[model samples]
Target chain A: MTDIATRATRVVAATGGRRRLNGGGPRAGTIAAFLIPFFLPFVLFYLVPIGYALWQSFLVVRRTGGQYGTSYTTFGGFEQYVQVFQNNEFWSSIGRIGLFGIVQVPVMLFVALIMALLLDTPLLKIKSFFRITAFMPYAVPGVIAAIMWSFLYSPQLSPLIDLLNGIGLHPDFLGPGAVLWSAANVSTWLWTGYNMLIMFSALQAIPQELYEAAKLDGASNWAIAWKIKVPIIAPSIILTTVFSIIGTLQLYAEPAVLRQISSNISSTFTPNMLAYAVASGNNYQQAAAISVVIALITFVLSFGFMRLTSKRAGL
Target chain B: MSNQTLIRESRVSRTVVMALMFVLAIYFLLPIYFLIVAATKPQGDLASTNGLAFSHFQLFKNLGTLFSQSNGIFLQWALNSVIYAVLGAVVGTLLSALCGYALAKFTFRGREFLFSVILGGVLVPTTALALPLFLLFSATGIVNTYLAVFLPSIVSPFGVYLARIFAAAAVPEEILESARLDGAGEFRTFFSVAIKLMAPSLVTIFLFQFVAIWNNFFLPMVMLQKESLFPITLGLYEWNGQTSRVPLLQESVITGSLVSIVPVIIVFILLQRFWRTGLAAGSLK
Candidate 1:
C-alpha cells in the first residue's frame, strides 16, 4: 500500500506541469454529468434570454379590434427594428456612448498602463501600499462609487469645489456640458486600478532576463519599457481593450446613479439606460430590439477591433 | 551622459515617477476617503462642515438608523447581498471546476464547439440579458425571489473559462489514472484528488465570481422588486434617490455605502495574491 501510494505521488508530481492530459479520464455519461449543472443554467439563463429577446423583438403589440380593444403581440417582421433604426434618441445615445468610449477607454487604459509600468519598475518604494490603495476603489460597487463621487461633484457640499473656487478657477463638474465626463471620471477611478493590475501582472510575468540583453546594449529604461516590455504585453493590452469596449457598451450604473443628482443626464443617456427606460415604460418589444442592436454593435466593434489589431500587428 | 550625471538624472526621474504615482494614488482614493469622512458626520453637519473633514462621531448613530429604519430593512438587504454573492459564487465555482476539469481531461466529441459557444457567452453583455431574463423569470413564476438572482448568478462562463485554464495547468492526469486503477469512480476521484490539487486555483475563481456577483446591480435590479430581497447596491440606490425627501437618509446612505463596501474591500486585500494570478492566467496566456 505504501509503495503504491509513493508511486502514485511520484506520477502526480512528474506530470503536473503538462497542459493537456486528455483522452484517458471519463466516459460520455460521466462527462455529461459534470457539464450538465453548468450548461443547464448557461442555456436557461444565457442562451434562452438571447433567443427570447430576439423572438420578443420581432413581435409587436397590437390591439385586437380598435382603440379600446384588448392588446396582444403578433409578428411585426422588422417593424420594431425599423422603429429602432429611426429613433433619434437611440442614435444620439449611441453617439454619446461612442464618444464617451472613444475618450474614456483610452484615457483610463493609458493611465492604467503608466501606473502598471511605474509599479513594475525598481524605482518605486512601498509598492503594495500604492497598489492596494489605488485598487481599493474597485471593491466599491459602481453605484456606490458614483454615489461617493457625486458628493465630491455636487456644488452644495464639495470641498474640492470650494478649493477650486479659492483658486479662482470656478468649474462646474455637474453642469450639462461636463456631467457626461463627470460620469466618465467615476468609471475611470473605479476601473483604472483593476486594469492596471491586469497590465501589471502581465508585466510581472516578463522574465528579468528579457531585459538583460537590452540593458547590456545600453538601452535606457524608457526604451526598454516601450520597446521590450510593452511589445511583449501587447496581447494582454488587446484583451483589456476588448473587455473595456464591452464594458463601455454596457455603461449604465454610473450614469444612472449620476442622473439621481444631476438633471443633465436624461432618461436616454445610454443605450442600456434607454433600454431600461423603454422596458419600464411597458415597451418590452422595442426594448428587446434595442438590446439586440446593442449586443450586435458590441459584437461588431469588439470583434472588428480584435481583427483589425491582430491583422495590423500580426498578432 | 557620464555616470555621475546619469545618477543625478536617475534620481530626478525616479522622483518624477514616484511623484506621478503618488498623485494618481490620491486621485483614485479621494472619493473613498471623502465617503468615509461623510459617513462619520451627523446629518445636520453634512453640508455645514467641510466635506473632507470629520465633523463629529455620528457613525454608530447613523448605522443604527440605517439598520433600524423601516423594520431593519437595511440589514435584510445586507443579508440578501451576502446570500446572493457567497452562495452564488460557491455554486458557480464548483460547477465551473467540474465542467472545466472535464473539458481539460476528456477528449469527447463536440467539446471544442461547446467551449466556443461558452466563450462567446463571455462577450455577451449581461445587462442586455436582464429585461428578457426578467420577462422569462416572470413566465416561470420565479421573479422577485432569491432564486431569481441566485440562479442566473451561478452561470458564469468566464469562471468556466478560467477554470479550464487552471485545471489544464494544475491537475495531473496521472493521478486520476492511478485513482481509477484503485477503483475509485470519476466523481469520487475528482472530489478526493483533483479538488485538493486545484484548491488554490479554485480560490481564485471563487474570488472572481464573488466580486462579480457582489458587484452585480443590473440583474438583481430587474429580477427583484421586493425591498427585502434587494442587494445593498439597489437598496442604497433607492435610498439615495429618496434623499431629497428624507434629508436624514443622506447620512444613512453614506453610512450604508461605507458599511456595504468595507467587508468586500477587506476580502479583496486579503486575497490580493489570487487576483494577480487569476488575471495573469486569464490575459497573458
Candidate 2:
C-alpha cells in the first residue's frame, strides 16, 4: 500500500514537474485546444453581441437631417430609456401580454397536468401512441404551427369561419375584438402538449409505492392525483409555468404571422414588436432602450417567481 | 358492499377519463386535419367545399401545381431547412459533447465559472439578442448569408447544460481514468468510451437543436435578404404576404405548409425511440 501510494505521488509529481516545464498532461492542452475552437465562435457571436446590446441600451442616437437623409448626430444618455418608460405603446403591449398570461397560463397548465395524470394512470391503453400524438406538435416548427393555425383562423379558409358563415353569422376571427383570443388559442394548441410531456415525465418519476400506500388507505384516484401526485410534480409544473410566462412576454412569431392575415395588430402589438418598429423606424436609441427594459423585466419576473416557489417548496 | 361501491366509483371515473381523452385527441388532431383538407383544394374549391370534408382529394394535383408554379422555390426552401437542421444538429451536438465531457470529467480551473455562465445564458431570451446579432452580422458583412443563421445556432447554452448533466450521469470517471492510464489520449478517451456512454443524450440534444434551428424565423427574417436563401419558414411568409396580389400563391402556401411538416414528422417518428429512452433514463436520476 505504501509503495502504491508513493508511486501515485511520484506520478503526480512527475506530471506536475512536466507541466511546470512544458505543460500538464495532454488533457490540459487537448481540452484547451478543443474548447477554444468551439468557444471562440460563441464568444464572438453570442457573447459580444449580448454585450453590445447592453452597451447600446445605455446610449441613444440623434438624427440631424429630414426623413430623406439623416446622419447620426449625438448620444443621449438615459433619455431614450425615459422615452421607453413614458411610451403608452410599450405599456399597452406589456398589459396585453399580461392579460395573455393571466388567461393562458392556468388553462394550458391545467390541461397539461390533467393529460399527464391520465397518462400516468396504469389503466390507460396505448400510452405510447397517445404520448406520440400529444408530443408530436412540439416537433412542429413554431413558424409552421403559427402559419397552420393562422390559416385555420383566416377569414378566407377557416373552418370555424365557414361554419359560422354557414350558420349565417360571419364572426371575424381576425377582428380586433376576437384576435387576441384567436392568437391565444393558437399558442395553447402548439404548447399544451409540450408542457404535458414535461409534466408526464415528472409524474412518471414518482415511485409506485406511494400510490400503493395511498390505495391501501382507500384513496380515490382524484385524491391520489391531488394530494400525492400534484405536490410531487409541483416543481415541474412551476418550471413549465415560468417557461410559459417568459414565452408569452417575448411573443412575436404568432402575432407577426397573424398580422399578415389581419389588420388588427399594430406597430406596438407586443413589446418585441414595438422594439422592431422603433428600430425599423430609425428610432434606434429608443428601440435599444425598450429592448433593455423588456429584458430586465423578463429577468426579474422569471427569477423572482423561481425564487419564491423554490423557497415555498423548501428546496 | 364497500368493495362494490369502490369499484363503481372507479368505473365511472374511468369512463369520464376516457371521454376526456377522446375529446383531447380530437383537439390535437384538429388543425392537422384542417391542413390536409386545405392542401387538397385548389384556390376556387377552397371556399366552396365544406372545410372539413374531402373535396375530390386533389392532393397530388395541388402538390404538383405548388411545385410547378413558383420555379420550385418550395423545393429549395425544403432543401435549405434540411441542410440547416442536419448540419447544425451534427456540429452542435459534437461540440456540446466535447464541452460537456470536459466539464463533467475534468477538474479544471474556471470550470464552475464557465458552467454557471452557460446556465445563466440559457435563460437569456433569444429576442433580446436578435437585434444585436443583426447589427453584428451587418457589421461583419455576413448578413443575408447562411452563416448568419448557422453560426449563432452552433453554440446552444441549453445544449451544453443538458450535455453536461448527461455526461456526468452516464460516463463513469473511473473508465476515463483507466483509459488515460492505458495511454489512450484524452480526445481518444472522449471519443471512445465517453461518447458511447453519452450517445443517447447527444441524440436528444441534436433533435432539440434541430427543431429549434428549423423553426427559427425571427433571426432569418432579420438576417437574410436574398430570396433563394430563404428557409421554408421565411419562404412561407413571403408567399403568405403576396397571396392577396396573386391568389395562386395562396394555394402554393398551403401546399408548402403541408410539405414543410413532412420532414419534421419524419424526424420525430424516427428519433422517438432514443427520445423516449433518453427521457425515461433522465427522469430516473
Candidate 3:
C-alpha cells in the first residue's frame, strides 16, 4: 500500500511539474464551464431538495378558523418529528425494515461470500457462465423482479405450489407471516450476484504469493480461504454490507409492487413507502419528517459501519 | 497410497462443488424460466396447466394484446421509458464526464472540497428527496411533467463519482500537456483527446445511469400523475394493481413484465465486460 502511494505521489509530482511548465492549469472560466452543467442539476435536484425537506420537516399544518377552515402551513419546530416518532405506522415500518436488515443482509452477504469463494477456487468450471447467471438478476429492475416473483408466490398461478401440494407440503409465500421474507427473497436474488462480484473481484486482487506460502505450509484450500482470503477481503465485505444496509432501509419498489398482489403488505410496509403514502395523502410535512428520519438512520448506519471497518483494518 | 487418497478426496469435493453450483444456477434461472413459460401460455392454462410446460403457444397473442391494450398505452410507456432512460443516460454521462474531467485534470481552488461535496451526495438516499422534490416541483408547476423525472434522473452523483475516478486513472497528464502545448483550448483538448481515452469508462457510466433511470420507481411515482407519462415500471405496477378487479389484465401484466426485462437482460449480456470492470472499480474505490 505504501509503495502504491509513493508511486501515485511520484506520478502526481511529475504531472504537477509538467503542468507548471505548460503555463499553469486551465483558467477558472474553463473549470466553471465544465462543472456548472453537472452542479446545476445536482444542486437543484439533490442539494436544494434536501434543504427543502429539512425546512418542511419543521413546519406543521394548521386549520385557522373552524374544523372546515382553510389549512395552511406554519413554523412548528419539531412538531412533525414528534408526530412521526409517535406514529404507530411509522414505528411498525421501521421495525419491519430493521428486522429485514438484520436477517436479509447477513444471509445475502453470506451467500455472496460463499459464491465468491467458490468462484475463486479451482474447483469451479465454466466460471463465466456461473458469474453471468448469478449477476443477471442485478440487471432486472426491482419492480419487475418483484412482479415476476409475485407470480411464483401466487397460489392461483404457481406450479411450484402445485408440485409442493402433490408432495403434501404447502408453502404460503405471500402470507402475512411469510411475505416479508418473500420480499427479502426478491432482494437477495437481485443483489446476491452483485455482491458476489464485488467479493470475487476483491478475492482476485489477493496476491498469489500469499497463497503460495499457505500452500507450501500444507494448509488446505479451505483453510487458506477461511484464514487468508476472507480476512483480506474484509473491507470489501464491509462495503457491500454498508450498501445493503442503505438499500434495505430504502426498500420501496419491491414491497410496493408486491403489495398489489398480496394483502399482507400494507400501505406502510416500508418506511419509504410509508413516506410516499403520506406525501400522496397531502401530509407533506410529516412525510418530510419521515424522510429525514430515514436519511439520518442511513447516514448513521453507513458511516458507523465504515468507521468500524476502517478501524479494524487499521487504515 | 497418500497420493491416491488425495486424488479421491479432491474428486469428491469437486463433484460436491459442481452440484452445489448447478443447483444455485437453477435457483437463479427458475423465475425467468417461469416467466417465459407463463408468457407463452393462454390465460386459461396459466393456472390449470403446469408452469414449466407449454400447453398452447400464445406468446404472439399475449404480445399482441400487450401492445394493443388501452389504446397502446404499453407501447407509449415503453417509449417513455426509452426516452427517459436513454436521453437521461446520454446527457448524464456527458455532464458527469465533463465535471469529472475538470475535477481530475484541473488544479482549481476548492477542487477537493467540491469533490467531497459530490461524494456526500453519493450517500444521500434519493428516496428521501422524493417528497421534497414533489413539493418543490409542484410549487414550480413542473410536477406531473416529463421534466420532473428527467431532470432528477440526469443528476447522478454516483455517475459523477465513477467518472472522476475513471478520468483520474485513464486520462494521462502528459497527453493533456501535449494538447495544451499544441495550442488546443481546454475544451478542445477534452473533446478531442480526453473523451476518447475515457470512452470505455463512459460506456460503463452510461449503462449504470441507464439501468438506474429504467429501474427508478419512487421518483416517477411521485413526480408524474398522468398515465401517459408513466415509465414501464410505474405502468406495469399500475396494471398489476388492477389485476384483482380485471383478472384478464394479469396475463398482459405478466407478458409486459417479461417484455420490459428482455432488453435490459440483453444489454447486460452483451455489455458484460463493461459491467464487470465497473463493479471491480466501484468495490476497489
Candidate 4:
C-alpha cells in the first residue's frame, strides 16, 4: 500500500511539471501578436527602405569585365561623392537657395511678427475676420498657391500687368532677374499667414493681466510689443525661423511647377531639383550622395541656428 | 466722454477698420477669385478677358470637358490622392495614437530612449530620407507601388511625438490604473477608456496627416512613375506642362485646381473646432 501511494505522488508531481511548462511563456512572444499589425508594415516600408538607400548610396553600378555583357564593376570608392561635389550646376543651385534663405527667412518672420502684433491690438475690431482672412492662404495647398501666383505673375493673366499697362509700363515679372523675387513673393504670400497664425497663437497666450498692468503703467503699444510680447514669444519665433530655413533648403514643388510655365528655371534650379535631375539622368549614386550632403547641411544649419539664437536670447 | 461723441468716434473708426479689412480680404482672396474666374472663361476668354472678371461662367461645360479629357485621368489622379491621403492619415494616426498611449501610460524598458529617438526624427526632414527610402524599397522590389509612398508616410515621427505629448496631457495615469484594477485588459482599456480621452488629439493628428499627405508632391513624384498614380499636385503640373501645347487643358487644369481646394475647404470647416483649439494648445506648449 505505501509503495502504491508513493508512485501516485510521483505521478502527480510529473503532471504539475508539465502544466508549468505550458502555462506561462515569454511576454515577447505573446505581445508579438498584438504588435505585428502595427510594426510589420512600418518596418517593411520605412526602416528597410531607408536602410537600402544608405547601402545603395555607397555602391557603384559598374558594367563588369572584358566580356560584352558581364562586366559588373567595383565600389570605385567615393567617386560618386566626388562627382556630386564637383557638379557645377548642383553647387550653383545650392548657392542660389542659400541666397534665397538669406532673403526669405527674415522677411517672412518679420512680417508674421508685425501681423501678429497688429492683430493683438486692443483697438482692433472684427478680429476674427482679419485672422481668418490672414490665415486663409494656409488652407490652399502650396502647389495650388504656386500655380495661382504664376497666373497673377503672368503677362497674359495678371491684372496687375493690366493696371501697369494702363499706366504705360509693361514691367517684366517672369524675367530672369525678377523671377527669383517673384518666386519668393509666392512663398511669402502662402506662408506669412501660416507663420502669423503660429505667432498669433503664442501672442494670445500671454496673460491679459500683464497687458492690463502694462496699460496702467502707461506703456505704449510699441513698447509693450517690443519689450514684453516679443521677448516672451522668442522661442516661438525661433521655432518658426528654423522651420522656414529647413523648408527653403528643401524647396522643390514650387520650383518644379514654375519650371513648366517659365523657361528660365532649368532642370537644376534648386538643390532638390538638381538631385532629381541627376537621378533622372541615371546617376542615382551621385544623386544619393548629393541628397545625403544636403540633408546633413540642412540639419546642421537648423540646429546650429536654434542654438546660436537661443544663446543670444539667454535662454 | 459724452455718449454722442463716443458713438461718433466709434462709427468713424469702424468704417476705417472695415475699409482696411476689405483691402486685406481682397489681397487674400484674389487667387481663388482669379482661379474661379479663369475656370469659368473659355480658353480664348482666359487670354483676352480680365483675369478677375466672370465671362459667362462656363461651370458645367468645364466640368464636362475636364472629366471627358484623357479618359477622365484627372478623376483617376484625384482618386489616387484621396486613397493615399485617407489611408496614410488613418493608418498613421492610429499607430501614432497607440504608440503614444503606450509610452504615456506604460512603464517599460527603453521607453525614454524610444521617445527621444522619435523626437530626433521630428527634426529630420522627409526629403532628407526620401533618397535612402527609395533605394531601400527598390532593393526589396516594392518601388513604384502605392505601398512605397503610403508606407513611409505612415511613420511620421512628428505625429508620434505630438501623440505622446497629447496623450500625457489628455489621459491621466490614475484612470488607466483604475481600468486595470477593474480587470479590463490593456487592449480593452486603451480602446475604450484611453481612446475616448484622446479623441481631440487624435482628430488633430488625423487632420495634420490628411493635409500633409494631400499637399505632398515630392514623395509621389519620386516613388511613382505611372501617370495613373500621380496625386493632383503632380497631375496638375503635368497637365499644365501640356497646356502650353494643348490649350484646352488650361480650362481643365484651372477647373481641377479650383475643385481640388473644395475637399480641403470642407475639411477645414468641419474640423475647424478641433484644429483651432489644437493649434492654440500646441503653440502654448
Candidate 5:
C-alpha cells in the first residue's frame, strides 16, 4: 500500500528524478518530433494569444474622425490599464465576484468537507448511490445547470416560489439583491460533489491504523472526524478551496445564462463577462487590459493560497 | 451501564448522520429531478403545473420538436459538440501522450523548463484567452468556422501534465532499454509497448478533455456566430434566451438541456472508476 501510495504521488507530482542515460538517451531530433505536435498548437493557441493580449493591452484604439471611421491600434503606454482602473463597472464586477467568492467558496467547501466526512464514515448506507447523486452535477455543464436553476428560481414557473408563498414568506431568487447568491447557488450545486469526491479520495488514502488507534482510545466518530481526519485531509481541503477560488473568479456562464431570464443580472455581472462585453462593444484594448488584470489576479490568488497553505502546513 | 449508554449514544449519532446524508442526497438530486420532470411536460403545462410533478408526457413530442425545429439545428448542435469533443480528445490525447512520454523517459536539455512552461499554461485561464483568440481567428478569417473552437480545444496543457505523470508512473526504463536493444525505432517502441502500458491513463485524459470541450461555452460564444456551428450548451442557451419571445421554445430548451446532459451523465456513472482514479491521482499531486 505504501509503495502504491508513493508511486501515485510520483505520478501526480510529475517531478520524479530524471532518468540518467549512458549515451544521453534519445536524440534531440526525436524528442522534438514527439513534442512538436503538442507545442505547435500550444504556441499557436495558448502562448501566442497570451503575448498578443499583453501587446494589445498596451495599444490604444484610435478612431479617425468620421462616420465609418478607420480604427488602428497604436502603442499608448499604460493608457488602457488606466482606463480599466477608472472603469467603475470593471471594479464593481470584480467586487461582486469578490463578495461571491468570500461567501460562496467557504460555504461550498464546508459542505463538501462534511459530505466527504459523512461518506468516509460507516454510518452511511448505500454509499455509492449517495456518492453518484452528489457527483452527478459535475457532469452537467454550467449553462444547463444555470438553465435548470433559472426555471426553479422563476417566480412565474417555480413551485418553490409557490411553496414559499404558501408559507406567507415571499422569495425572490432573481431580485437584484438576491441574483448574485442565486448564481452562487448554481456554482455550489455544480461543484460541491466534485470537491467532496476529492476530499473523500484523500480520506480513503489515510491508513486504517490511523483510525484504529483513535477508536481504541474511545474517540467518538465526531471527535475522530473533526480532530484526526480533518487535519490529515487539510491539503485536500486547501486544494479544493484554491480551485473554487479560481472558478469563482471566472464566473461567466451561470450569470450569463441567468441574464437571459433576469433583467436584474447586468451584462457585466462578472469580470469575464465584463471583458466580453467590452470586447463586443469594439473596445478591444480595454478588454485586453481587463483580461490581463483578471489573469494576474487569478495567478496571485491561486499561488498565494498555495504558498500560504504550504507555509501553514510546514509550521 | 456506562458501556450500554455509550452504545446507545453512538446509535443516536449514527441516525443523525444517516438523516443528514439522506437530506443531502435529495438536495443534490433535486434540480436534476426538476429538470427531468420539467422536460416531460408540454408547453402549457410547464407554466401551469407543479414543477416537481409531471403534467402530460410530452418528452417524445418535445424531443421531436427540438430536433425538427430550426431545420433540425439541435441535431447539428449535438453533432457539433460530439465532433468537437471526440476529435479534440483523440488528437489531444495522442499529442499529450507523445510529449509526456518524451518528458518522462528521455534525457534531454531544457525538458524541465518546457514542462514548467506547460504547467504555467495550466494556470492561465482559458476564459482570459477567448477574446484574444477571437481577434486572432478573425484576422485569419476563421472566426465563425469549426476550426476556431477545434484548434484551441485540442491544446490541453492539463492533458499533457496528466500524460507526463502517467508516463512516469506506468512506463518502466528496463522495457524501453530492452526494446531499444531489439532494434526497434523510438516511435515503434512507443507505439508497440509504451502505449499499451499507458492505455488506461490515456482514457482518463480523453475523458477529461472530452468533458472540458463538451462543457465549453465561452470560446464558442465568442467565436461562432452561425447557429449550426453552436455546441449544445451554446445552442440551448440561445434557445433559452428566446423563450420569452416564443414561450413554446421553453419546453424544447428544457428537453434539449436534458437531452444534452444525458449522455455525459451516463458516461460519468458507467466509467466512474476511471474518474475516481483520475481525481485521486490529481489531488495527491
Candidate 6:
C-alpha cells in the first residue's frame, strides 16, 4: 500500500537527514510522506475543487442534436465567464457587497481597535469578562446568530423594536433598505470580538519598554497610544483588514439565514448567494464561474489591501 | 497639572471608558439575553409576554418537545455536529502537526513552494469550495453522506500553517536528533517525542479546527440533504426556513438554537486560553 511506502520512505529520509545534517538538499520520497496526508486531501478537497470549478466554468452546456437529444458538456471557452460578466444579479450582488464592505469593515474594525486599545489600557477592570462576553457570539454559528438576531429584528418579538417604539422612533431592521445593514450588524456582532482578540493579542505582545520610553519623554497616554502602540500594531490591523475584506466577499450564511425571515434578501443578495442560487437552479457551470469570479475578487481585494497597507504598516 | 486635578481627570475618563464598554457589552449580550428569556417562554408566551421577561418556566417543556419532535432529529443533529467537530479536529490536528513538523524539521527541496501553495489555500473561500466539492462528491456517489462534510473539515490549511510555526518553535532540532540517534524512525520520533513537545500547540490547532468545523453551515447545507445527517446549524436553518408554513416549529427552532449553541459557548469559554494563545500566535505571521 501507499501508506507502507510512505512510512518506509520517511524512515529512509530521516536516516538520510540525520547523516547528512546538511538537509541533503532534498528528499523527494521523505517529504512526500509527511506532506501526502495533508496534501492528498488538500488537493482532492481544496485545490482540486478550485481547479474543477475553474474547468467547469469554462465549459458550456451542450446537447448533441436537439432538446430530446442527450445532453453533454463540450468545449466552450469563456462562454460561462461571458454570461457571469453579463449577469445583472452578479454585478448587483457585487455592488451590494461593495457597499456592505465599505461601511461595515471599517466600522467593525474601528470598534474592535477601540475595544482592544481599551482592554490594553490600565483603566479597564474585568477585562476578561468583557472580552469573553464579546467573544461569545463568535462561538454562535452564523445560522444561529442570524436566527437569534432575526428575533431581535422581528417586530412581534424584538425587545429593540419595543425599546425604539417607546422612544417614538419606528425602526425596521429587516426592511428592504435596512435588512442589508441588519445582516451587517449580525456580522459585526459575531466578528468584532474575534477581531478585537486578534488586535488585543498583538497589543499584548508589545513590550513595556516602548511605553516607558514614551512616558519618559513626557508623552501623554493619548500620544503614547496613538504614536507608539498603534504604529507597533499596524501590521495586525492590516491583517484584520485583509481578513475582513475576504470575509465580506464570502458573505453567505447570515444573509441566507436572514432570508428565512425577510423577503428583502433576494436569492442573489450576495455573490455567494448568487452562486448558490445558480448552483441550486442546476446551472452548475454558471455557479462555478460565479464562484471563480468571487474567489478572484476576494484574492485581489485581500492581497490588494495587504499590498496597499504593508508599507505604511511597516511590514 | 496638580495631583488632585490629574486624579479627577483620570477618574472621569475611567468612568467614561467603562460606560462606553458597558453599552457595547449590552449590544453584544442583549440578543443572547433575549434568546435565553424567549427559550424559557412557551409557544403562546413567546408573543404574548415581554420579549425580555421570562413569562413562564417553559424551557424544560420546550426542550422536551425539542427532543421528542420527529423522534429526536435535533438530538441527531447535535450528535452529528459533535462527531464532525470532534473527530475532524482530532484528525486534522494530527495531520497538520505531522506535515508541519516535517516541513519545519526537514529542509526538503520543494518545502517552500509547498508551504506557499498551502498558504494560498487558506485564502480560498471555503464556502465557494463547497459547491464544486458537492459536484465532485455527487459524481463519486458520496453526496449527503457524513464523509462529504467530514473529509473536507479535516483539511485546514490554517491549522497546518499554525502547526508549522508551533513545530518550529516547540520541537527543537536537537530533540529530534536525539530521538533519531536512539534508532527511532520518523514516525516513531514524531509520535513519541515531537508530539509530546508540541502538545499545547496541537490542542490549539484542535480547538481551531473544532470551531471552524462546528460553525460551518454552507458546506453541510450544500453537501448533505439527508435530514438525519444534517449538522445542528443546517437543522436549525431548515426548521427556521419552514416556520412560515409551520408556525409551531418556531418554538422548537428557538429552543433548538439555544441547545445547539450552549455546548460550543461553554467549550469555547473554557478552552479560551488555548485558542486565544494560538490565535495570537497564528495572526503574528
Name the lDDT value of residue A11 in candidate 3. Answer: 59
Q: For all the predictions, what are the DockQ values?
A: 0.55, 0.52, 0.63, 0.37, 0.61, 0.61
Q: Predictions ranked by DockQ, top down?
A: 3, 6, 5, 1, 2, 4
Residue A161 CA displacement from its true place in model 2, Å: 3.3
| lDDT, candidate 5, B235-283, per-residue tens | 9999999988998899888999999999999999999988887777777
Which DockQ-derived CAPRI band holds candidate 4? acceptable
Please give the lDDT score at residue A36 for candidate 4: 49
Per-residue lDDT over B1-285 for candidate 2, one digit per residue giving the tens place of the 0 to 100 score? 999997897788778887788788877788888888888887788877777987777889989988876688888888888887789889988887788777776655567788888777767778877888888888889989889888887878777877888888898878877898998988888888889988878889888888889988888887888988888999998888887789778878888888888768777978887665444443332
Alpha-carbon lDDT, every model: 0.91, 0.80, 0.91, 0.78, 0.90, 0.89
Off by over 4 Å in 1: A1-24
Q: Quote fnat for model 4.
A: 0.44
TM-score of every candidate relative to the true structure: 0.95, 0.93, 0.96, 0.89, 0.95, 0.95
Cα lDDT of model 2 by residue, A1-315, tens digit: 998985675556455753421223354577676577557776876778778877787775555667666766365677778888898999999999899889998899999899999999865767777777777777776777878888778776778787787789977778998888888887888889878887888887778998998899878788999999998888888778878888888888888888888899886899999998888886666776787888788889888998998889887
TM-score of 3: 0.96
Q: Which digits, one per residue and each the tens of the lDDT, describe model 4 over residues A1-315?
A: 998975575455445453221222213332343334545665665555456555556778766555575644357677777787888897899888988889988998897887788788765777777777677777777788888888888888788799899989988888887777778877887788778877888888888888888989978677899999999988888878877887898888887777778888888988988888888887777777888778778889988998899789898
On residues B99-150, what C-alpha lDDT tens digit does candidate 1 reach at each position? 9988887765567799999899999999999999999999989999999999
Q: What is the C-alpha RMSD of each candidate to the true structure, in Å?
A: 5.5, 4.0, 3.2, 8.5, 4.3, 4.7
Candidate 5: stretches off by over 4 Å: A1-24, A63-71
Instruction: Identify the CAPRI category of the predicted complex in candidate 6.
Output: medium
lDDT of 3 by residue, A195-310 (tens): 99989988988889999988998999999999999988888898899889989999999999888888899999999989988987989889899999999999999999899889
TM-score of 2: 0.93
Q: Show pairs that collide, candidate 5.
A: none
lDDT of 3 by residue, B1-285 (tens): 999999999999999999998888888999999999999988888888899898899899999999999999999999999999999999999999999988888765567799999988988888898889989999999999999999999998888888988999999999998999999999999999999999999999999999999999989998888999999999999999898899999899989989999999998999998987777777775
